[model samples]
Target: MSDQTTQRHPNILFILADNLGYGELGVYGGGPLRGAPTPHIDGLAAEGLRLTNMNMEPQCTPSRSSMLTGRHAIRSGTYAVPLGGVPEGLTQWEITLPKLLSDAGYATALYGKWHLGRDDGRLPNDQGFDEWYGIPRTTHETTWLTSPGYAPELVRPQHIMEGRKGEPSRELQVYDMQERRVIDAEITRRTVAFMEERARGHQPFYLFTSLTQPHFPTLPHPRFAGSTGKGDWADMLAEMDHNVGEMLAAIDRLGLRENTIVIFTSDNGAEFIKPWEGWAGPWRGAYFTALEGGLRVPFILRWPGQVPPGLTSDELVHGVDLFTTLATIAGVAIPQDRPIDGVNQCDLFQGTSAKSGRDGLLVWVDNRLQAVKWRNFKAHFYQQDTMMSPPEKLPVPFIIDLYTNPREEEGKRASGWVLEPMLKMVQAFEASLVEHPAIPMGTPDPYEPPRRCP
Candidate 1:
């Protein structure tokens, strides 16, 4: 190999949790949930960098889209869960993170839940992933393990399939909705197999291990079922942590640990209802709304020599920022024509910079503008008076101070933070809304509303 090729390009192991909170893990002071500890995850944090101000979309699909596209979820055409795939889907025009890295000679594979799109063309394969396994959509109907055989009532529609280069696609109903377990061992085994395969190859790889764990209808394997002191939720979390430990162990066994960059974060905050007795730390509320508990999540990144170990950073960061950061680390050029919301913050992770490249970030839920994070201030807006109300009232918009309000623990009282700058930013965003209207509320219509969901 040439000198350039001999200089190892960092491998990426990105793990995303479904609904995790900032305070749930040991490193984050989550405390023992029923006596079980996230030692693996905490160890990773202790040996890597822990981001204290990491933010994400309030829901799963949007956040997933943001992570892949490096753009705000609104730009991805997935404002909310599409009932009939209306307003088009995540357009092919956008270059995804995996696709970008793949183009630059990285082998990309996405394992576990891919809730971004359901159509094959819109699936991970079409979006630059070299290999894909797991559910393509977020529906309670499909089980991850025993699908197509044990037909059970599905709570929603989901696509479960596996694909590789030049291989005929295999569709299976492996998921068991009622049981709430995706045959844990199978998923872990496949992941291990992938890791082993990649270890034998010379090419750098980007593997997105998107586990469907700690989500609703929580189910931990028999071994982990009463392991945690918190209950089933804690048990499920412990199981998820165990899977992570397995993956990390594979990296060590394959001697890929030093050269690989392992990033662990959640898609969003915990759900409204705690699934496995999971706590959002001090944050209040759960998924589906613009609350601290809904967006602020635990973020840990480990790259032996590249990232400083055992460092904690409170600088603001977002899931969208991962694309540019990875691109910068890989020394790849990002296209300048399209708007990329993410900024390369590798320095921030290294503990050399306290400044966040972003001045502000707009948070969207179900395609509607729900919150804005400007510096230390975060303004959370709601459409209707109710927490889960429709997007109509959101058009008016409002503001809140996240640092002072934190998780809205104070109830209706304001944190006394000024709203002028936030209002200005919201106005600018609203003006931009002219070009990209919110997905119309209510049922389907020939005449769509001016505002669209993000």
Candidate 2:
């Protein structure tokens, strides 16, 4: 690792959208065609690199945990979203990205939805952030207060929370539909303020501005409710575009554009809910499934002079790869005690290399090995049509050439040889579990990895 004092580490502004799909932004394919224009986000891509084949976990909790820990969500006990008050999230033992950056002398703050945990020891501040403000769980709870036959004692109303490190989170207000409409704007405002303050102090900061937009029950701010005139969904898209523009403008205004790395991506593919559901462009299925639509999402990164502008790559990069990639960029050492699934992709991001460090990644949905994506080929051990349907366990691995079947539909068969590499990747991963067993879902705190034999 480089000396922190000698090398001024670049600031990281990671803006994550909830349930945003690959085709949602204009650069990849949708924007105006989807009835809302994303000029601001598109401009960001025009000034940076746009990744077409970026893959994430099938759901929010899994993807987020994977990225932060640089390990598979299954290894960290967060393979799926916690439901029915299940206490599922990252254990205290996991080494998160924000924690690493903080140790490297970077100030950290998280604004927006944090689906990682709802308990004291599992929250953002507890993990690594210096200060944080966001919902402790998913936005789906915002509707719980209004649902028919709702009972407060059964499931308490979700609240907007704020906290600093070493302090309990302060519950602000009930996060209802009205509050949901305005919360994103607040996140952006606080993020901009944090950027300004850190820039003034001449400190490198890692700002995880996680936005809760275009998720289920998608609603735009009151001011933008009807701005698009296409519908509420389009209106929400327009609002998100404007908010992202504000953040970009702030970086430029603070004169931090040249030194800050601005990233825009999502935790999942798209919403599986109806009416408020999002478009995955050309892919099939939705969030919570093993299909391409569930695994692929939009990813854009901008770093003036350092990262080449207006370049696009189809290189396969997993969401967990960001951990090692950013840690390398920030001059931090990745922990060697655990199996880190993320590989360094700094060269790929800087345009010096056309190939990603990883050629394949195992796809886990609900703690089960559902699929394996090796280069442009994919082999599925389980098949799921949508989030609402039951998964079918196949006796034989089903193979598809993603180049010809981006939709993963029946057509353009892949050679049987593709299975050999896929099998090798899966076998190596399973063998690793023998030494470092995966933490079971809902594992309590004060957790420790099982002892490895010499």
- TM-scores, in order shown? 0.86, 0.97
Backbone clash numbers for all candidates listed: 23, 0
Which parts of model 2 are misplaced by more than 4 Å? Answer: 1-7, 84-86
* Candidate 1 lDDT, 1-454, residue by residue in tens: 2325524568899998877766778778764743468889999999899888888887787888788878777765665655553533466666788888888888889888887666555677877888888877653444433555443364344546788744544676645564346444556777788878877765678899888876766677777877765677777778888888998999899888888899999988875553343567877766777777777899999999888888888888988899899888887888785567788898888777878777777777776677777877766566432235554554434555666666554354444354677678778766756765543322222333355467
Clashes, model 2: 0
The true-versus-predicted C-alpha distance at residue 3 of model 2, in Å, is 14
Give one digit per residue, the lDDT tens place, for model 2 in 1-454.
Answer: 2335424799999999999887888877888877799999999999999998899998999999999989999888899888845666888999999999999889999999998888888889999999999899878788888889999997789889999999988999989988999999999999999999987788889999999998888989999998978998889889999999999999999988888999999998988897888888899988998898888899999999988999899999999999999999988999999899999999999999999999999999888899999999998888788888888999888899887888887666678898988889988998888888999888888889877667
In angstroms, how far off is 363's CA in candidate 2? 0.6
On TM-score, the leading prediction is: 2
